[model samples]
Target: MSEVVETTDCTNGTTTTYDVVVEDARIVTPNEVVRGSVAVDDGRIVAVETGEFDADGDTHIDADGRVLMPGLIDLHGDDIEQHLYPRSNAAVDPPMALASADRANISSGITTKFHAIAFEDNPEKDRSPELAMDLVESIRSNDSLLADHRIHARCEITDAPCIDAVEEVLVNDAASLVSVMSHVPGKGQFRNIEKFREYYENDANLSVEEADELIEERISLTEAELSTRIDRIVTAARDSGVVVASHDDETPVEVERLDDRGIDISEYPITLDAAQRARDLGMFTAMGAPNLVRGGSQWGNLATEEAIEEDVADALLADYHPPSLLAAPFVDTGETLSTRVARVTKNPADAVGLTDRGRVKEGARADLILVDPEPTPVVEHALVDGEPVYKAEAPR
Candidate 1:
């Protein structure tokens, strides 16, 4: 996947003229929120200063005390799949789905979106592993898109063939982010077998008897097979320099084992102890933003609010909702605004080795969002590489 895009009509050294300038905004920096004006030229931030700029810009936006922060970088979101397969078997055209998902993410302030395509062997309607891999390739190759859409290959280690599928994507350079995951019942996110049954009942529309058969099949994978599969996938990810993350960490011991295996991130640790262990080991811990917005996890797991209060969470994933990721920073997590903002921006970017675009510093990529945070958090303007991708209409 390509990270750098062509800069257009950018500012030059001889002339301080900028392509765009945003004035009177509450800028969210790495450590503090300061009122300033930002000048963007040639897809990069050229100036950060207090108040308005004297130089001319192609366009000037009045931020009016609203938050001007780095656009949200969603590290793990399955919402693309939802857009693809809106109903059980009904499917939307891939191009249309991509367009819709891009608009949704851009409108919600997500400048970079990692579409989590599953490599798990799902036998449900329109939920085949083949479809997931196809979607990955499509998202990676599409050029006409708003958000920087990248592929996050979710490799279920329990399925040997799916693990191979993940390795293929890595070797082909189709996925930027790769995670080794296992959603088997009675462990990790599905520790309670009954909850797993309920999930499959709704997700796959399976009867209890069929769900029981699935449980048996999932648990039948030998420990040796699990180790071999995970080693293969993780090694391939490391060899390709792709960021490797572990999903649904269940225990402190599990977190430690994943950390030892060189996982850079822990996505949705099932227990606080697991999340704490990940942070202690210097691995970023990510939780679903929807979990925070909805007050708790849909399934019984670590509450995102508690994770933040405990200082174990480092980033928040949109997971399945773009609006949740946009509003999560303002959801009263009992933290400073700057601190909360980083969870959706700088932290996730740093996790995926995307350091240049996730912060609002001078010389960083001009990917930013302006938002009104009073009655509700709504994106007023969204820019990727200093070009306006989404802008709300002015009030009548």
Candidate 2:
């Protein structure tokens, strides 16, 4: 399954040849899966066809009939927080944490990642506006990362201080995606006050009374102020051509409001009704892959599998675990393998406005992963832009 293709190098005024050939791969695309080889030249997929081609190449990879699919496009994942703050009081340098996360992402078959950074003004949590801004800077300035890294600012609406920070990031062109979220006790992910209390106490080490007091203070803000700040943030993000998403939408009304504000994606809609309404309004709906793997949402919300069954979910996000992106397609989703794979690949890429990469097709970016799904799914090889970024060695 090797191919030889010819090309003309206009700048050099000479004819060139294919650089690499990935042979004998079970290439998985959005439409079908076929045993074939892929030809790459200058970091783009030049051809994908069955059978062997009598063409020479500079490098040859024996895919060995492994599943070669597009590298994952993760629209939302916060696993970097774990590497950044491995312990309660211990924190790693931002660049070091990001570099570690990049390796983990490429190892997990993620070629494009949007690191969800929460911008909250919580005194108890370390997710401050300054830290979020710093992460944006660190992710943008670093060029040695394996995966294509982008910032997805989780703008906590109640955190008034974060509004300016969001504006600044947009102005500086640092963030590629922005999602407006409100985690007050009575709504969104915290609709269950007791669950909210437990989470606050456990994460921030706050007493129940302290958590309640903080909730009360957060809810005390006037609706007018919150609405105004949200409008400003959304406007700025939209003006800057950043993809806008709504997080934890709980009702049709919420979905409609976000839709009216030009939100392109709805993340983690809490109820089936909300997800359905978001879909009806032409908004792409995303759910956590971890929820699908765990069989239920951790917070007793809408299950990911159920959402997919009901045709309310358009994409699956890694959420807190990068490995979940590749593992989710193997779950019992009651859908075709191609459909399941699209939830983590093509659908998310479309939702995030990335049109070039997500499928194994001709004239597309050569971001692909060779996976062995038997026993356990393992990323045997990961290629970003036709270059091998991660290659697993043979087991003993």
Candidate 3:
């Protein structure tokens, strides 16, 4: 583990003041916030102090009395998939889709993102494995996007027939996080018949007749069948050393079973009990950023703010909206802006085992965002590892 180092050398000794100076901004770190000038050299924060200073750099940004903080680390988001297939029946260019997704990501100050691509074995949502593989290749090949994008594969274990697809993604090293999901209608997270009905019948763009058929298919799975598939996927996760997360756990019993399988992350535990169990078991608890932004869960599950208040939630993921990760908590929590920012930045980074980034501290990776805090606090600029990726247009 690389320890964080502090740098305090000033232009008092050398002719060069600093490589890059971000001044006139409110800087938010993990523990505190200060109106300061943050200097960057060799892509690491060198100094953070209040007061203007002469600086020399290939680039400089005047934050204009706005907020400067660590770029958000989004652990789960489906915005990329939405870009690839904007409409239910349409397919966009894979590379273009990724580029568009990255641009959207930066607009919200997310410097690092784990794109959760669902491996849907269901005929309606499953893209061809070849197409999925191509998209992953595009993301890896083109890393000069607005944010650092990694792959998080959502493997529907109940779709046991499609295990080959999951294995292929992992073997190709396209998957960074693996989540086991099951859509069996009668049980598991979607146990509420009305919730399942609303999702497939209306939200999924399926005709009522077609939705009925899909529901029937899901309801056909027996406990024995589901258990067998779960065992197989859990075994695969263990062997690969892939970070395994459980999705939408609703009960303590469900969390206990997930814990027994060596799961380290609990993605959206539906109930307070399940979330509490996850926290006690030392699993990283991830809630949707949208939930916090929207003020409640759309499906009537655990509210993100309530979860945070209870201290059951450890990380906030931008489940669908990338920007919500930047905006939601700021409004929900009464904490100083800096503290709200840490929940999205440092907290998630620490949970996912990416400690090098997240905080705006010396020796940390220069994944930072500078925003004008206007037009609903737009992301005026974005930087990753001291490299500029996006700069918003000047106001009219």
TM-score of each predicted structure versus truth: 0.94, 0.94, 0.91
Each model's C-alpha lDDT? 0.87, 0.87, 0.78
| Model 2 regions lying over 4 Å from their true place | 1-16
> Given candidate 3, what's the lDDT at residue 310?
90
lDDT for each residue of candidate 3 in 64-163, tens digit (9 for 90 to 100): 7788899889988988878998987688888889989988988888888898877765446635455556777888899558688898877776565456
lDDT of 1 by residue, 34-109 (tens): 9989988889998989865565577778888899999999999988877898887889888889989999889999
Candidate 1 residue pairs in clash (backbone atoms < 3 Å): 10-42
Once fitted onto the true fold, the runs of candidate 1 whose alpha carbons sit more than 4 angstroms away are 1-15, 394-396
Clashing pairs in 3: none
Q: Against the correct fold, how does model 2 do in TM-score?
A: 0.94
What lDDT, from 0 to 1, does candidate 3 have?
A: 0.78
Q: What's the ranking of the predictions by TM-score, best on top?
A: 1, 2, 3
| Of candidates 3 and 2, the better by TM-score | 2
Measured with C-alpha atoms, the lDDT of residue 202 in candidate 1 is 88
Candidates 2 and 3, the one with greater lDDT? 2
